[model samples]
Target: MNRKTLVLPAVIGLLAPVLAACGGSDDGGRAGGAITVGTTDSYTASKEAPAPLDPAYAYDAGSWNLLRQTLQTLMTMPRGGGEPVPEAAKECGFTDSGNERYECTLRDGLKFASGDAITATDVKYSIDRVLGIKASTGVSGLLSTVDTIETQGYKKVIFHLRTPDATFPYKLATPVAGIVHPEEYPRDKLRTGFKVDGSGPYTLRAEVKGDTIAKAVFTKNDRYTGQLTPKNNSIELRPFADADAMGAALDKGDIDLMTRTMTPAQVEKLSSATTGDVKLTATPGLEIRYLGFNTEAPVVRDKAVRQAMAQIIDRGQLASTVYGEMAEPLFSLVPANITGHSNAFFNKYGAPSADKARQILSKAGVTTPVRLTLNYTTDHYGSGTKKEFEVLKTQLDRSGLFKVEIKGTKWTDFRADGLDGKYAVYGLGWFPDFPDADNFLAPFLDEGNFLALPYVNSAIRDDLIPQSRREADRLIASDSIEEIQNIVADDVPVLPLWQGKQYVAARDDIQGVEWALDSSSNLQLWELSRGVSG
Candidate 1:
């Protein structure tokens, strides 16, 4: 799931089983043209409605994009037509010196839906504001490498960095760089629960937060003059609280698209349930899952204990039992098909062997009383997460070397607890910065490693990162990545569980379903359409 290069989601075609729900008496009009998508995570309106829209403080990807409508970036994705182009800025090449300064120009007539000209001041306010509010949650980490962001003019933005990071442009492409409304938010105060005001194609129409249901309906902004080529003219994003409930809604034909959490069996149910009418397509995604260790923990400080734990987990059984066959065993931090990735951890610890695991812990003098608490998120991923953790507890307990205790928390509590290094060991899943190896490396390997594995690899932080980001040649980049992998293996910070697979079901009549790209499963939204069967 982690990768060293810009990669898209893996595309896995569906193995469908025709079922009752997806099949029904078909009338002449194409299967009720509107598609109903489902997801489990319930969305909430932070009193500000979407206030943290400030790029320096924006956290979620969707809200970032929505607010980006009003803001602008210097460059965009798809070197030459990757997919839907962003509004705001046009593409330009950076200096090969890696991290060398560069500039971008905004397309003519671009302005906020509010009629405010998107000048460089807005860009400066969005980026520089991040460094100003670094103390807030996730803001500092996102703004770490940003040395300085300055505006040359109304349309041009210049970024001078503390390091020569060639990947800065791509980072800008992420929602993290989504422009913000300077008129609405102030830099000093991290605005929370504020409505998102952007120049994007859609505007926040309404919100419903009670009962843990948050929904935002958007309509075309006549004032918008950006790159987002809208197809449907409007979209509605609704967040559901439960994954199973969301799945049921999809089966009952309540939404058009579903992206969140779904087990393999449930996926199979949807694919089969739809028969040929409900199309299920998978894309290689930047979405990644890993086991994180809190270095502050005494037991985990021992290399043998960590190594032994890495050795005994059976990914194959775990995937099938909990995630179903949809989950694949992940061996490396960087995902497959991405550059700068290596299975070093897998090379160090092969298949499971509890007997051998016991010996390692015993040799390390970790007596029977050695107890490890495994933390699991009750609501973040999906329904089977708790059960999966229970299985992990069983495996570790069966070893008889260490007593394992299982703990569960909702996503909010889990994130706070995990970030504070409260749990000795926890699980993490990443979507990616921009589907690049740098994203996988920078966030995890930099001075402040996320898992509380505080590793300060000066070479990686200073030399390797700059060198890799600067080099365009894939082969040379591979060498730098190999070095990074070697260092990761030597340190053994995290164990890669598996690259998760997502199943998306749409009506057969829908066209332009590329189901590709490993970045984020958030489709272009513009690429999908429904009409008469071909």
Candidate 2:
């Protein structure tokens, strides 16, 4: 998911500003205690996201974090991350040898939060509405391969695919495939407002301030008939404007847990501090940051200019100085931890070298001191963004082969400008829709990519991507995946920066802090509970 703004496809929108203290008071106890969770993320009901929580429209992690609590998908990832497993469905699998047809049988006596029965029709309708709406900010692109959905009787649903896509089940595990009641959500338009009517682990009651989601209260849904069982009776999610504000809330006992968008300073303090009751848990993250070039732009459009910039930027210094070593220097579009990952960029560029950058520009017959404008969001991706860009500008300037100007704007305008191709180069972050190499590469390199960049590579997009998706065994797709990375490294449409680590800061008495987030980094609030001594 796009990290900070509305991502066009399966990208996540990161943290935003919202009211901090608006949820229910925390009731202290053991397992069933009401847990208060805090984040800096916010979602607004706008053209980009007409319905902040509608399964068909909400594409940001903040919205998905809440949606996963109230909406059940046909399939879901296991708690610690693995293959897609049956959740609402009793069984699901590819019905054809070509992986073109998928079928699922609904569990008996399934019911929505409103007590309405969840049938195969609801499953078909949920997917159909998502495809029909085709919201630019929605994850409809994830289901583009599906030709049509067919329902048999009241329990069986089948999907006919236009192409052989073995990754379809992983797509189903995402919030984009979340089931919505037919009566609550419309057929062709997004259902607006802050209410949810699905039969997930929780029933939601949210408070909104204008377009900002101030707070959300989740009560355990007694009608939920899924594999997950709630560890707590209730949960209260509060949103803050920044890391400092959220850290203050945690320090003062205003929140039982704090996660998503924790600053490097905050993580360092929590790691070293021995006086406070706070504890920090870090996990290998799928979140990645990169520099996206507008291939049609005047200056960065030149392959030499893009290559020179890539050759000069120092990822090790950037990660250590700016992120306090919380993030790892990334060389490939796919994260290092994910299968089929490769160090293609590192293999080509080697260490950061200005001499090599000058030679590449010289060989391409491009004039020296090429001018470029780099853009980034001011409020998104934490407070270090400005400093990050400042450091980037310094690095490019030091090369003596380029003149770089960095600009900052609010996330809404920044995203709009980037999509409109207003900058020569801009920074973007990705939180995967699913944990796969395809999630990282396909969304950025494919035709009509989420980045809105004019990067077109027929071999990688038309052949390699489809080839990889056809393999039921993802391990067998490594050759195709590696070839795609090499092509990306050569084209230089987007330069990989750093891969971040997921951090959750919670009170020492909080249980299951490590298991609160799923593979795609979506919060599973049901896993959170108070310890016996809490």
Candidate 3:
């Protein structure tokens, strides 16, 4: 997922039988009550009003969170970590040895919230629309492997891929593959306005203030024929400008539960509440925060300069001083819990050394006191960014080998500037699209990577990554991640800083706190409830 957006994950084994046995259980509770959630526009279903309520066009986590509840995909990653299970599909699997062809048959008696019959044609149309519209924010890239999509009558849909991709099913679980009403969403244009025609467990009704969505009300869709059933009859999403506002509402009981917008300070305040009114639960996340370099920038282009910068920065100090224990030091692009993660940066640079940095710079003929500007978003990344950069500047300046200038902007502008290659050095954070090691590759290494930084390592982009994607066994594919990490360490295109843990702070009455986060770190609102006191 884009640093500007948030996304999900899990491992796989047997899927078809597991889904068949589990079928969906609504045993915990009967639908009643209402859930009011508060979050920032950063987590909204659409980045802007009039952008379309279509899931095919959504690119952010807030939107995806909503989409996951309201739109049924062929499969879905269940809460807490496991395999992607059948959701809309009764069964799905690869049809050939190449892993290039896949097929799925829809669950019988399916219908959109509009009462239109759901069929294989709608599935084919939804996938075709994503690839056809090709919106800048749309997830068409998730289907890049698809050569063509064919449907057989109203039940089966088939995908013919350009090459083998074992992770294809995981992609099917993402918002990109969300199924929409065939007649409502146009084939070539995005459907506008605040309302959505969907087939998930919820039907959306929204309220707009001026040009932005002020509130969204989701009611249980009685027509939904999937495993997940709403625990509550209605869910209200209230968007705020920042975490402090959201936290205040939660404290005042204006909102029953809160999901993605809380900042560190707000989290601390709620967690340490003397009143014991709020509770906090954390999910182990695959999110990684790092500093990226625009290799085309005149000041940061040199490999030695990048290496020197890496040598002088101390992640341990940054973690304790700037982030507290909210994050832990990350020495590789891929986090430690994942396979192929190695402390390559640590092995090459050792401990922070100003003297070593200076020696390396001098050997490369870089004059004393190299100068550059450090960039970050003041709010997009949360409340600690300003201090994080301040600490970073101090660390490099104290070395006596560098002089630094710091700059900050809000998320919208910062993302635009970074994408345009305006920053020499900038901070970026990623919430993975999927949990596999391969996710760490294409976004940062492939030709014309998501960074938009002018970096195309032929050995990595052309050879290593493509070779790795062909391996169905992730363990075997992980061998390539080691080589990729070592290459990135040498190239220094981006420096891995820390990996974060997910936090959900809500009223003590809320239950299913543990299952709210799927393995990929995406919020599962369907799992949430109130008055359970769990």
Candidate 4:
């Protein structure tokens, strides 16, 4: 089920001498003057933490959103909502009885940002590039069902799927499908520093890396002329080593914009600071928190064992203790806003009960404590993560029926460890690709999907996903997604924790800060520029 909305929180300026002391920009609305943003998003430019301008590897939230906006997909939701908006392709239709042969008719007179006329060859080359780098990129898996991608005229491209996929167009509208200049981009790395060439509104102009790089300034993309909501000529994306240091930098007028590692405590502190020039936006929607149990492990394979363990989690108390009132109990993998999601799990599980858990364990012939290891990313999910896990460990240990060992790993390494089938228990947070049941269903259900968890459920993997993909109706798609989720809740291989709250800080001068489906919340720079500049 596909759903979309455009809403960004706005606050009036909190201007004072204190705010001026910290920075020039007010914390209220944005006016598009000089803006310095700060965020604690650290990424290394190496093979392990490789820097990829290519959209296919746009896995990280920060990079994905920018690349998504900078590059144009063959089709897009102009409002960033539902279905394809036909940015590149004017008309799209389906052929073949199984709905596998999808054809598209494109709009002519389009050119790459580099001034090269777009052609069917360019389309082929762009897609073929991702298909080529399937191994290193991790993008190959997202497109595994594709049999072939063909082009008819300079404007039209047809995708032949091994199986029927109705939601393929939605996928096409995603950043992963971002079309790049075929002439410049070859099999591997992007050519130069932020020098992007695409048929989008914005064109990459200048990108200064660090104080180490030649230039240390950010500027507007020259090629951007497409109808956009662009408010600022240039938006600066700066990474801070830590949130505290970044917070200090923002106070000292060192940065203009910020994201990543933003928490409630930080927002509360920064927003209410005597220097309250920075606007803090309260973003809403599916920022999900959950505990993923490796079902493949022999210890978790037993349903009684897993269910008993889930029963021991004090979700309500835990939510209050770790997340405070900012979070809610997640009963289903799909959030309430997502189509077809109901509190079905809540109806089934209810509040945590230790007596029932002990009963289940006793029935399973488990007399002693169930020893388990819980894993999480130390630096990725902000400072509150380890504390949150500590609460969970305490709750589980309080049951007196289980022994828990908590393990923390860095973000990049934690994923590799999961892929190696190393951890039996781990904490995972999901920021959706799109606001739909499909995003919830596919990620958690598909065995070949994320974490490479072998969630081999034929009904979900083979039937449900294919069924929802072909059925274009959102309600129908939601029904399929809901049925699949019921299976997930019953399986209890993973336990729901809490859904997160999105926060963004803008100056009173700024406006039009739209939240993207993937939780890549940035100022919709176009819709918001200088608002009544003083």
The lDDT of each candidate is: 0.61, 0.82, 0.75, 0.63
| Model 4 accuracy (lDDT, Cα) | 0.63
Best-first order by TM-score:
2, 3, 1, 4
- Model 4, position 349, has a per-residue lDDT of 65
lDDT of 3 by residue, 301-321 (tens): 888889999999999999778
Q: What's the lDDT for residue 189 in model 2?
A: 88
> Over the stretch 1-534, how does candidate 4's per-residue lDDT look in tens digits?
011111343211111111111223322223444444555654434344444456645555555555655776776654434445566676776777667988877666766666767767677677766666653335445565678889875767888898887777766666667777766677665443344567765554434454112212234445443334444555555666667777676657666445566655676565455544455545554678887777778777777777886777877777777666457778888776666787756676677888988888788887658888789988767777888889988988888888888889987678667766778888888776666677666766675566567657788887888888777677777777778777776778677777766665554444343331223243244443434322
Q: Tens digits of per-residue lDDT for model 1 on 1-534?
A: 110111223422221222113223223123554333455654444432334445555554444444443344554454222322434776444544665675656666767777877777777777776667653336346556677766766667777766655566666666556666787767787665636666766566546555243665556677766565554455565667676677666666677556666666666665455233455555455567777876658868776787787778887777778887567777777777576678776776677888877777788887665688988888767777788788888877777766889898876667667767788888767766565566676677775444445546789878887778676564567788878877766566676777776556555554444431224544454444444432
| Candidates 1 and 3, the one with greater lDDT | 3
TM-score, per-candidate, Cα-based: 0.86, 0.92, 0.88, 0.84
Pairs of residues at least 3 apart in sequence or in different chains that clash in candidate 2: 1-11, 1-12, 1-431, 2-11, 2-12, 3-14, 4-14
Q: Model 1 Cα displacement at 477 (Å)?
A: 2.1
What are the RMSD figures for all models against the true structure? 5.8, 6.4, 5.6, 6.3
Best by lDDT: 2
| RMSD score of candidate 2 (Å) | 6.4
**Model 1's TM-score against the true structure:** 0.86
